[model samples]
Target: MSMLNIPLFFQDTAAVEGDMGMLWMLLSGILVFFMQAGFTLVESGMTRAKNAVNIAMKNFLDICVGSITFWLVGYSLMYGDTSNGWFFWGGFMQGEGADLFFQTMFAATAATIVSGAIAGRTKYTTYIIFSLLMTAVIYPISGGWQWQGDGWLTKLGFIDFAGSSIVHSVGGWAALVAAFMVGPRIGKYVDGKVLPIPGHNQILATLGVFILWLGWFGFNGGSQLAWGGDDATGASTVVLITNLAAAAGGLGALITTWIWYGKPNLAQSLNGALAGLVSITAGCGNMTATGALLAGLIGGVIVVFSIEFIEKKLKIDDAIGAVSVHGVCGAWGTLVIGLWGVDGDTGIGLFNGGGAAQLGSQAIGVLAYAVWAIVLSAIVLGILKATLGLRVTEEEEIKGLDISEHGSIAYPGKRQREFEE
Candidate 1:
């Protein structure tokens, strides 16, 4: 039969479906792409003005280098064809051009997250090496288990709707390890007490947070992979829940910080917004709006305590609160499914009637990512520390990396002049 003989209903419906799906994916991609700018500003704003150029440069370079690495090897390892499900080295080494594009963006995101943690003191060369290794090796391997079609984790029924475990947690663990190995920023700790290292520009930092929140729509929405059919409905729900969570997160953080510090802290509130976003990432599509709000609120509250505990007690120097915002919140988001997934054929929430099965899965996934990312990041940073050296010299650290590494200042010709008393 001639192709023109085909029924118009089927052909038109298929074309419409394809077009809608493509539109959704493209929009989502644009959203995720914008996050790079958000990251750049956030890192620059949080660090000292003296090293602003260096911080921005590291973020820029990571996207470039990380993108290339993922294209060449990372995507294949993570999502390429697999036979036995788990372990190392998947058979699908080369990704289709379309899939590669999406995967590359995610890989770059993981690489950039580390820049904030190791800002100010690390050598530029060392930073590049770490970024390349993380995207090309560590992140891809871990991502395979959850997102890969034939990976053991996926087969084992593990779920991460967005990337709480795959993306944020991986970055968090790496950041934690890097900060420990690189040691605290100069004078960040003195007399056995942690000192506050206030960000240089709160306005810039807040602007960056807003950008990140805007970009998250794409981050969670795209994960739905819906273009038509029932998937489109699910995608819309994801977007709704994501926004609700972010709103709840901001409010939760604002209230808690106001109470704890006896004032409304802009920085903590901003962090709360991010915490809510991260907490809902893993289960946005699965949970209801109310579930998302509660998850975000709890995530905001948890981040406040986690940040203080890690910095004050553990003595870890996380310059911009990456560990708490990404790591702790990411874990909470992933596990929230067990506590709040809608009941029925899908599953039951803990509050409703669910047991520990799903929660246990979340814990295992968390443990797997935490151990792998921390151990590998430590090894990579430790090797760099011993060989080419991870940190700039004490003089450079004190003087700032913009001049020491880049030979240019972020705000040129603004040097402060000192007069003898």
Candidate 2:
């Protein structure tokens, strides 16, 4: 049932199902909002102590800045009356404010994903501008291509259950371009070799991972967008597969790293869990339990290799592995739907006799998102690079963004001497 048919207004009391969906969606949006805290903690904990305040500020402002801009422009671009084209101006839309709030959270998430990629050295002013642009223009326009009722991709039957390719991969592609434009963190690459710059707070990072895990329940679950009868049952099933896949992904990463590096690393394990979550998101509604597990396991292993490849070969400096966990794994989840999605009113995977057609559809959708997101981000960041500059000066970077950018330190007493030294 299309949300358009559901009467969400209180005056339309006949629509009990819409009311249930509204409640469920509100709960889910609240949960996803908590993910900002998770992203903040992870970004801060993973980077140097000197930049913790800067990272925190970026995450917080992503929500504050992202919400208002998306409200004013992004929602209409995504969910308004769209033309039947690849790109359409959705125009200023008026709908349920509650639904708008739910989508705004997702917009914030897409913008926030880039924060980790360009963590250490980006200018705060430049970031704020980019965040607003991304939510108001980049993300929403791309989103319109899929989610809008009259968009071309929807006509072509591209499926993204909860935005694996739509939200996560869009952010990933932008991150890839933005990180390339910003350059790596200072000392990340000296001479020819890629050096390891481990995060400062593993415990805090671990806690952040746990919080993200909890929030994903809402992320994937509420995406069902309905609540009565079969919708409720399906939502519970989605929650189950989501949890199982995450577990499997963590285990897969743990075992792979243990076998390859000779130890089970916590950071890799946490990333693996996230990898699984991203991997399963596109197929959460249509996949069987076994399929979800396999997809997640594949996602976990894929992130390990993808991270190394990006670091060593591509030489992209992603501080928190956002590119691998969200971008690479998100693509996997979307593609896997072509391989194993159930046949019904929902979707039909190739493995279930849907044929190569679905796989072809998935590929085109992923490629389209990559090209569109990367090109737009590169253009925006390139323009910014030529004018405002992307990275901080060497002296400011050495002093830390917290002091250089914000004139304050996250841990003034303990780190002041070390920073001076």
Candidate 3:
């Protein structure tokens, strides 16, 4: 019997369920879509005046290119039904309309994370290619293993309430690999000493951070997939814990940085807020407010120390600290799910009651993502580096991307007077 020839009674229930799923997915998609603006403002404010336009333009183009690529190939690869253990295929044609919309936003997010890492130095053309490849290939394959129904990770009992590993960690790993491949921005390191590259405007960056924090409510909250009744209680709890974690993250970063650095740095505090949000993403629905608070606080402290360690010890130059904020803290958040999620009914920590099973599962998930992301990113970046040349020439580097690549200055005629003075 043809699908269209099926009896009305049989078809009606399926149709209703499909519509509800689409609605939930659409709401979540809208929330994730707004993150682009948050990223643009945050990245632009964190860099030098000479490169602000370039930074903003890269973010804009990432959304554009990323959306197209994901629609064309990413969505199917990521969530398409398949049977393979290590790899899956979604064919060329699958997922239409709303399903496409939700997955496209996720693809864009993975692409945008790289923008912050290579902010000042990368060529726009190269960045565009990277974005296209990430959405079209890298992110989809990894996400497929976790989000797709038939995915091995899902079968293994891995639970990522939002996207601590799927989205944030993937981006973070790509950024870490790219930063090492691209090398430090000019004058960032001199005579084996790390030179500070102060953000052009902390206030603007702070505003951008706040925008991201606001959007995260929709991010974590929307992931609940429902908002009413006892059936939707999980969604409500997720929202509450997400908010508490964010607040705790801010406080934790503020206190820790104040003690360590002798003052409450606004930038660090802002990062602390983001750190908390990222850390709680994996377990927002599974944890309590208290667990969220502790998780966020630890995430904040981890980001500060991770940032310092990467710069000082590893010599990896991440322009906006994307590596530490997303990569390190994202891993921590995923692990916390094992330690803090409610075991059966009572909310408690692993130290209090939760067993080692969840913790081991969390560790396995983290290790798997780390290995997959780093190896895949290295392969993708290496190919791009060999084929098109990843970094700009020394002449172009000194001239600034706005003028060299786009043939316009971000500040126009102001440069002449500023230089003369």
Each model's TM-score, in the order given? 0.92, 0.92, 0.89
Clashes of each: 4, 0, 0
* Over 4 Å off, model 3: 1-24, 82-96, 229-233, 343-349, 416-421
- Candidate 2 residue-wise lDDT, 139-192, digit = tens: 998888878767888888888888998999999989988988899988889999
Per TM-score, what order, best first?
Answer: 2, 1, 3
The TM-score of predicted model 1 comes to 0.92
Q: What lDDT would each prediction earn against the true structure?
A: 0.82, 0.86, 0.80
Candidate 3 lDDT, tens digit per residue, 1-421? 8756897677777565556655766776787788888888788778776677788888889889888777667776786653322232333333245556777787788788888888778878778888888888888888888777678888877778788888889889889999999889888999999998777778888888887887787677766654432422356677788888888888888998899999998878888999999999988877767878999999988988998999999999999889888888989999898887764365444665767777887788888888888998898789889989789877776767666677666677575333111
Q: Quote model 2's TM-score.
A: 0.92
lDDT (tens digit, per residue) of candidate 1 on 45-73: 88788778888898788778977788677
Task: Flag the better candidate by TM-score, 1 or 3.
Answer: 1
Better of 1 and 2 by lDDT: 2
TM-score of the candidate numbered 3? 0.89
